[model samples]
Target: MKIIKFGGSSLTDAISYHRVKDILLREKEDKVLVLSAMQGITKKLQKAIRTALKDEDEVECIIKEITKKHQIVATQAIRDTEILSDILERIEKKMKRLERLLYGINYTEEVTAKSRDMILSFGERLSVHIMEGIFRAEGIKSRAMEADEIGIITDGEFGNATADLKHTRKNLKKTIGQELDRGVIPVVTGFFGQSKDGYTTLFGFGGSDYTAGIIAYSLDSNVVEVWKDVDGFMSADPKLVSQAHFIDRLSYAEAAELAYFGAKILHPRIVQPLEPKGIPIVIKNAYNPDRTGTVIEKEGYQREDVIKSVAYTRDIGVIKIEGVGVGCKPGVLSFMASTVSEHGINIKSVITAQTSINFIVDMEDLEECYKLLRKKHSSAVEEVVKMEDEALIGIVGEGMSVTRGLAARVFSAIAEEHVNVDMISYGASKVAFYLIVKGKYIERAVKAIHKEFFKV
Candidate 1:
């Protein structure tokens, strides 16, 4: 059996829905289908939540728009009048519930972490019904199952919850196993799961990929197939370097690094659950299924180039703490790190020196980190600097640690572009190294590095 997941881009409109149906019909193995919301629907739902706190009328308008969008897709995708009507009715019921939830937020003038997660979950919840209805219209036995209903329990962390694997595995095997035995395809909702206390909890944005991984791990499937609009992982972003070509395969570590450093094709945490089971992830294009996409496994082929991809992200900032002996002081770094983490700010990388320590974090969290550090250790700290316009560029491949001259080549490429490197972090991970540069030079630096490694 295989676990197949369709991203939002693959299920955008009526034509896209039909394409997904055809893809599933061609699959021969007993499978479970995991789906994300239609393209742009989640964003609209997020907008509705925010609008709920300010303008109730605008929230209602957005709700209507969301309903109309799904209704149109349902009408076009399901040929049987009965299936179409049933799907439409289900959509209406979900919309009414969504409206009520948003109104609750409006009346209270607050959007707590719990309510926000509930608001975000409506996207996947709605899409699964449409997909299940389409499959049924084609005479395929299918059931629309939400993650919670199928017993996907999480740690209850609200915005970014982790699944309780032992409990989830036992529950999924019992619940979904019965459905599989009956030859029924369980079209499950992705992206969010129910907490221990029965609250809706999400796995962070673009977490549907993580959801697919969790389901694959729980069921002990042979492979996890992620169907998206792109062909596969590339040497670089095609928009940045038009010559960026497809990467046929990658190691689990290399793929995880690329995803974390802004690959965007897969979620950063998707590899975690699957790693324990040694499950391979195949990224295939839903629109062009005939093309072989990138495959990520435990051990990948060694490329002569010594670099698989140049991944870059502009959403980074550095917080530097300066003192006489900041690095030498044992509790200084720990104190600062714990303080920032307590407020839910994630520090991506930490570099230190005798006199200073630097913490790389998300750009949105830079100001808060600065204020937190300043307020806690004002007397002991000399200066707290926040560099918000920094971009992180990473060169990822399994052979990087053993290879020689690769760093020279990368630095030479950046030098050729006349881009100054603000800081560098290496040797922590065998598969990847990182470079921080000014945000203005990010494009130039990425293009230069891609040209050097890929010879484009």
Candidate 2:
């Protein structure tokens, strides 16, 4: 069995819908398909929800656009969209409820997390309907399954919610195969998940990827195809370096390293559950489905290059808490480390000196970390201590440790490029290495590394 997921851009319009049809025809085998909202719909829905809270008049305007976009796509994809009247009727009812919610928000003048979720949930809800409509009209047996129907449930944390995978897996296993056995392609709504309380919630960044991974894991499929705009994971950020190369294959650890340092290729959290199954994920281009974009699986797999990808994260800061005389003291080091973790701040990397320890964190949480350290270990530091906000550049690859001078090669390139390095970290694992540099130098740094490696 296979689970295919198409990103927003791949399902945005009639043309993209046809591309999907072609891809599906090629599969011609038992499969489950998942879909994200049409391109721009999610953002537009959120904006409308926000606008509705401030003024009741905008909901109609927003709903009109939503209806038209889907209608156009449906009309073009389906031979006889006359049957769309019933579908449109159902959608209209949902829109009417949305407009009424506008007045509700207007009177309250307060948009809570739950309210925002309830609004964004419309994106997937509507997309799945249009997709299933087009598929059915085209004589393809298909059915739409909303998040709640498949037990894609989460806590009522509102804006960002984590899925209860154990429950979701059981529910999906029972339902997905039955639909396939009945000759219906089960199209799942991506992103929103029902809460334990039945409220809607999201998984924040990379919500769509999370949805696909969850669906794939549940089915234990051979491959979870993530169809996207680009080819796959690139050697560098294309926006920064024009000559970046696409990595054909990478290990789960490689993808995680790149994602953590801001590769923008895959969600970092996608690895935890899916990779354990050894279910190789193929990232393919929706526009050019024939081309093999990239494959992510276990280590020691064959690959084209020693380096999988070079990625960077901007707007990062490093924080350091120095224990001048407590370096060898086991309990003291534990105290300082526990202090930062207790504040719910992630430690990107920790470098310990004879008397000091420096760690990296997201820039947004720098202040909280600063205050947390000051409160818990203020007396430990004898000299000045602080956090530094900087851009982080990472060179990720499998078997990088084998390339003796890989680290020096990167540092030397940065040096020749006149980019000042702020801090660096790497472990014995040697698959990846990260460096901190000024945000302004990102473009030049990425270009320099790309040219040195890819000659682009």
Candidate 3:
């Protein structure tokens, strides 16, 4: 069975919904439909939450807007006027109750994590209801499902909770199995879940993909297709590099590396389920579904290619350690690695000189990384300098290590464009090379590499 997810833009309105239905209907086999909240429902929900917390208007306006949008699609899709009207009323009432709870949260002088989770869950709640009605109206065998009903229990963390897979899989398997057997397409909610204690929980922003992957993997589905606005993970962020091309495929590790370093196209946990089960995910375009979007697999593509994608992250921390006694000490490097690791910060890159070693990490943990290492050996080391704002633009490919003079070509490309590279790193696998430079020069660096690799 295939688990198909329609992202926000794909199911934003009546027109998009109709197009999505056509796409699903065209498929011949049994499948499940996972949906994200409509394009702006989540944002409106956020605004409403704030208002409700402030004892302002109960956010009835935003709820009404959502109601109206869903109703318009229902009017076009649902042939049974009476049934559609009843369903619409049920949805509207639910929204009103959601608004009341938000106000009550304000009334109580508190918006507890548990309460906030339930409030935010309304986005997916409303979406699944509307889609279920649409499917039934069109003579499709489909049912709406609340997230909690399928056993996706998460931690009590309000904003960003991790999935409890064992429970999730057991519960979801029964529901999906029943639905598929009945030839019914179950439209499951994204972005929200419940706890072992019955409290509502969420899977964080962009966690919907995580939701879809979890479901797909647990149910042993053949594939998970993520339909998004972009065609796929591109050579670089299209907004940053206009000429960037879509990457056709990637290994799971490579995809995770990109996501870790500010790549927005894939969900961070999308691969977690696949990693253990060896499931493959296809990142396809909603706008142009047939395009060769990126396919992620457990195995690296055996076919050789010169380059894959040029990706970068501006949220980077660069620290230079310079001291007379720090040179060639047996324990000096050990101390550096151990201290940083203890802080739960991964060293993105580490470059060593005769008397210094410079390290780069994700910017958020810079202070913690610095403080831990500094307290232990700052004075003992000699001179310690930290560059807080820097970026790492990574040139990735399996062929780079084998490509003769690949390092020179990369540096030459950056030099010809007058871009400065402050540090460089290579791994034992020799699959990727990362260049650290001034954060402001990231775009310039990416453009230069893009031309060198692809434009050449």
Candidate 4:
């Protein structure tokens, strides 16, 4: 059996839903479907949450708009009017529940983590309901199931909860088995899971992929196919480097590195559960189903390609702590790390010299990191330098670690383009090489490096 996952883009509207139904109907293999919230639904939910927190009256309007859009999709996609009515009725009940939740938040004047999670879950709930109706109307045996119904229990981390797999596997096998035995396609909602205490929790932003991976591992399925907007993984962002092309295959490690650095094709954590089980992941285009997409496997493509892809991220900020004895001060680095950890800010990359330590972080966390440093460690640090508008460029491949002069060639390529790298790091796993550069020079740097290795 195979586990198939559809992203938000694949279920954006009635047209996209029709395309997805056709895609699934064409496949003959016994498969289970995983689905994300429809495109724009999650964002709309979030907007309503924000408005509710401020006690704004506009929250009701947003909620109505969201319900109207979903109602339209169901009406247009499902040909049977009775099925559409049933879906709309169910959606109305769910929307009322959401309104009540938002009203509670407005009355309390606070949006707690638990409340926020509950609000976000409506996206998947409504999406699965509509899709299940569409599938049944199209003469396919299908049923909608929540993540909790399949026993995807997670920790109480609210926004980015981690799954308890041992418990999850035990419960999932039984429930999913029962569905399969009944000859019904179980359509599971992605992203949110129930905690042990019954509170709603999400895996993260693009967590639906992670959800699919977990389900795949639990079921011990042969493969997990992720349907998205694009064909597959690309050598570079085509918007940044027009010459970038699709890569046919990648190792689990290479794919993780690319996603972590800025490849938007897959979420970084999606490969964690699949890697240990040696499960292969295939990325395909939902619109153009016939196109061959990228595949990620345990035994990666046995090719001599030293560099599989180049990925880059802009809006990185650098913090430099420099003092006469800062590097030698044993507790300085430890203190910095602990303080940052306390604030839940992740340091993307760190570079150290004889007298200074540089912490690279996302721009969203830059201000808080700086504020914390100034408040706690002003005395230990002599000078704190802030560098904004920086970008991180990463080159990923399994061969880079074993290959010699790859670093030299990469630097040569960037230097030829007159790009100055602020700091560099070779990932400990040897799957990727990352460098920090000015944001303004990121496009030129990526294009130059792509041309150097790919010669495109």
Number of the predicted model whose lDDT against the real structure is largest: 1
True-vs-predicted CA distance for residue 240, candidate 3, Å: 4.5
lDDT of 4 by residue, 61-99 (tens): 977899999999999888898888888999999999999
Cα distance off (Å), candidate 2, residue 252 = 1.2
Q: Choose the strongest candidate by TM-score.
A: 1
lDDT of 4 at 138: 79
RMSD of 2: 3.9
Every model's TM-score: 0.96, 0.84, 0.80, 0.95
Q: Which stretches of candidate 1 lie over 4 Å from their true place?
A: none
Q: Write the per-residue lDDT of candidate 1 for residues 1-456, one digit (tens) a residue.
A: 889999898988989988988888788998999999999989998888888999988877998899999999999889899988999999999999999999999999998888999989999999999998998998989999999888999999988899999999999998888999999999999999998899989998889989888989988899999999898999999999999999999999999999989998999789989999899999999979999999999887678898989999998999999999888877888888999988878899999999989999988889999999988973457999888889999999888889999989999998999999999988999999999999999999999999998899
Candidate order by decreasing TM-score? 1, 4, 2, 3
- Minimum summed lDDT over a 10-residue window in model 3 is located at 300-309
Cα lDDT tens digits, model 2, 1-456, are 888888787877887877887788799668888888888988898788778777677767887888788777777766655757656766777777766766677789887777777777777787787777777877888888888777886765665677788888888888877888799989888887888887778876467777878877887888888888889998888787766767787888888888888976677767766876888788888877789888888764423446666788875777766656655656766776788876556677776777877767778778887777776674667543565647888887777776677777778887898998877777645678888888888888877776766667
The TM-score between candidate 3 and the true structure equals 0.80
Q: To one decimal, what is the Cα RMSD in angstroms of model 3 from the true structure? A: 4.8
Off by over 4 Å in 2: 155-157, 301-305, 315-389, 401-404, 428-430, 454-456
Query: Which residue pairs of candidate 2 clash?
Result: none
For candidate 3, write residues 1-456 as lDDT tens digits: 788888787777777777777778877877888888888878877777787667556456666776787777767766677768877887878877886787687778777767777877887887787788778888888888888887887875666777788888898878778888899989999887787888878887677888888888789888888888777787777777788877778888777767765787777678887688888888877777677778888877532446677788888888777886565767887788888876547786678877888877778778887777777764548766778758887766655666777778889988987888888876644557787888788877888888887783
Alpha-carbon lDDT, every model: 0.91, 0.77, 0.77, 0.87
| lDDT over C-alpha atoms for residue 244 of model 1 | 92
